[model samples]
Target chain A: MKADNAAIVRFENLTLGYNHHPAVHHLHGEVAPGTLLAIVGPNGAGKSTLLKGIAGELRPFQGTIHLHGVRKENIAYLTQQSTLDNTFPIVVQDFVAMGLWRHFGAFRRFDATAERRIAESLAAVGLTGLENRPIGQLSGGQLQRARFAHVMLQDSPLVLLDEPYSAIDANTVHDLAGLVRRWNTEGRTVISVLHDLEHVRSEYPETLLLAREVIARGPTEAVLTAENLKRARQLAEEQGELVGAPVCAADEDAEQAIHAHLGHKHG
Target chain B: MSLVDTLASVPVLSPFIEFAFMRRALAGCLALSLGATPIGVFLMLRRMSLAGDAISHAILPGAAIGYLLAGLSLPAMTIGGLVAGVAVALLAGGVARNSVIKEDASLATFYLISLSAGVLIISMRGSSVDLLHILFGSVLALDDTALLLLAAFASLSIVAIAAGLRLIVLECCDPAYLARISHLGAVAHYGFMALVVLNLIGGFHALGTLMAVGIMILPSAAARFWVQTIAPLILVAIALAFAGSVVGLLLSYYVDLPAGPAIVLTLGGLYLLSMIVGPLGPLVSRRRPRWHFTR
Candidate 1:
């Protein structure tokens, strides 16, 4: 919502969509570096679309996202659903080694240091012994751990995760949430789309509650109020059931959200 | 000569040792196996074997058109097939991306249309004898020009595959991530599709359009039953394809069978064998071992 010094990512009235029907409406925000932010929304409320915009997967139809200096090499994004073909014939170690691809590329020989780092990432994710096993043979939890290992190896300044904990056992979630914390501690800007509002309240420092637009954004305590959340859910449910429903005016909702956010600040 | 005497007299090596046509066929098969098998392995790896089949079908009309215009000319048929095959592939893919019809469904629709158009055109302009030649190929009648085209195309295929090796693997494993990191995603995708069409053209020259895809797909599928890594899988597929081609040629020579189907059947036999007995196949590995790991 506000820029401090040089913002890591700044979105200017961004509208992202498919086939001219906007999934994410006009919005403006600036994310400071090293901010541990959580994006919370009802299903189809454009949380993933916002992340996709930041990851450069989707283009904004009518706005700009300035990434100060970050490029593809400096960012790591994990999709909501794994895009990997599990039936592929590749060992876990080799898959994890892809995080180092920006440096060593796909062809270079991984030196001893690179090898050690790969082993370390796998060990950190509790997949050290399973490195030689085919990635397809890994169970869901094991594969998620492997995914985290890959993200760890990315060593990027910006890390984006979409629903990293869905369908995962609680123990695995706790383990992965710890890794997310570790990344923020290392001064990486970490933005995640999470559905577990309770978990976000306890862990994420900043929260953006979105339902096709910014419903509330700022400190977790100020944004996750009961009134704002109920309103957000009601807005989402109104449009969720309709097939090709008429869109509400985007700027009108933005005005209401701004007023509500201001009232929270003064209160 | 009687069938038994014919088989006995010719033996294994004499097919090539005695006949100029047989020698030429062997050389053609060698070039084809070296180039096409790797592309087939990639097709299998991407799980686009069906797409490969569709493109093979899509090229039929192009080849038939060439036959109508030039009367069994190699360069004419090859260029026509390449143009038509790539066009259909791109069209289907574009429709899938721009609309809601999904890629496989779009490919199926376009290939059927293409096949019917080709069959109708050939029937209108050419005789059934010409149709059979285009459909089943004239491997024994491949001229020096055809032989040179095969060798040159095969060399080009190997070098192209090597150049795109890393991008291809990266695109296969995680393409969205690759796009996030670099702009090579389109190059990898279009380049791989181009290779698929190129190899199908080669396969159509050796086998008919109907069985061309069979040769490309079956050997690779069988190789997967045996090998777990990409490199070994491709190598085994190449070896299996070459062996199947040679043996099929010999079997056709002695038994008076159609060579294209014979080659495909030989590859099918190897696929079945691998499915039963290869180390990673169902019969060999999928059963319960009645044992557990102990620390």
Candidate 2:
């Protein structure tokens, strides 16, 4: 991949793994500015691992991950799975305001300005009236929107989401995509790992296919072809046969393979 | 005695004006609550409750060593305890990061090792009564120096928690982002753990190790049932701690009971009340509609 100012992120020969065990090897790619890139792959395909590497949660073993022509910072990441202490006592407004914490000094209080930003962010994510409600009181979709509201409050140019719409309501998924598209139009770069191929095909223009490595990377139409789909299915098959192993890929859906494999792309 | 006289004669209130030791004890109890409650709130939210418990217990060995090295002086013991506490937290964090062992398990292992080491050190150097005073506390015979130490700890904990409030909350909610942008997560964890250690050491004279953990955790747990935001949670926790202190002290003084248990029991009552009256939980506010007859 050629380096350019227009490029927001680049992974050169990136290899992600734990200790000596390699999960993905010799991956090379670049995510362009103002574009939404969807990462699609089978179970154990290292799709999330690739996103983790890009987000700086997981460091690549042998390759270089360069963001904005420099070292990676000013990047916002939302994890695929979060066990939020739902037992946690925090209001939606308070939760969203947390995104502004990095800008404040350790002792600094959230002034009226920060509070205003939190309100705007909540309103942006369609959580206007629910600001004072405790996070525990929110349904799954509402909770995810609240999380998106938090990310919106972060006000970063680069946003990375790991399955942002998973386990969310159809309305919430639509609202979230609208927000992402709005951000995309404003020139913010978005990279999300999506399980739904239909979402990638219809909602996203760019996609990267992976199975422990880069099976393909490019526009959604090119990368998410029948061959790549077969490769992803094969990877899923291999994953099911192996037990007691750490499969970090699309492992969350292997148990419901029957329902998962039926293509939702056309629907 | 009339009901009013009976109430007045209760130890919690009786100690207030009658004797200096009792007054100091009451003050100590209140201060301990203020010191430990906020720390507990953040610790629980961070899912580091066991880490707080571990660090609290782990302070015993250091306090014991401090006693052996510098006798009964507060400063020496405090410095010793702080050092040991920091060491244990760092070791646990390091182990958690490097090894496959989860953070809670690592903390548990650290706590057991440090606590046992402290007991052995105390046994080798001092009498059983002194050890008991250090381990289980002797709230009745607290001196001025003990009061000063407790006050200092309470002040430090309040300040530290106040300063780190936003960062601590943010870190607990979203550590991945913090790690990407700054050192807030790691720093907050260590800083908060240090404060917890200080509070444990400070309360050592009043409640001892076993009972101090209760003071630190119970009030916060009770407070959590009442509020939805971090700021409010801390405020409610502080208030609950104060109430517990006052009631517990009064009850203990008049009824001839230990201050620690009294405070813990009061906190437990608050928790039960919160469970019943809390607005968020299903148990407290079942969704079923209620129809009323003519009132």
Candidate 2 chain B, run of 10 with poorest lDDT: B286-295
Please, what are the lDDT tens digits per residue for candidate 1 over residues A1-267?
Answer: 223358789998887877768887777999988899999987888888899989888878666889965775568888889998888888899888888878877567779999999999998888878878888888888899999999999898789999999999998888889989988988888999999989999899999999888999999989999998998889888886522224656575457666886899999
B227 in model 1: Cα distance from truth in Å?
2.3
lDDT of 1 by residue, B1-295 (tens): 7665576475897778778998888888888788888888888888788888889988999988887889778888898899999998789889989998999899899889988988888898888988887788777877898888778878888998887787788798888778778777898899889988887888788787887887778889999988877778889999999999998899899998888888889999989999999878888786736245554
TM-score of each: 0.87, 0.84
The per-model lDDT (C-alpha) reads 0.85, 0.77
Clashing pairs in 1: none
Query: Which 10 consecutive residues of model 2 chain A have the lowest summed lDDT?
Result: A242-251
Best by DockQ, which number? 1
Q: Which stretches of model 1 miss by more than 4 angstroms?
A: A1-5, A19-21, A105-113, A225-228, A234-267, B1-10, B123-127, B282-285, B289-295
The window of 10 residues in a row where model 1 chain B has the poorest summed lDDT is B286-295
Which numbered prediction scores highest in TM-score against the true structure?
A: 1
RMSD of each: 6.5, 8.8
Error of 1 at A91 (Å): 1.8
Q: How is the predicted docking of candidate 2 categorized under the CAPRI scheme? A: acceptable
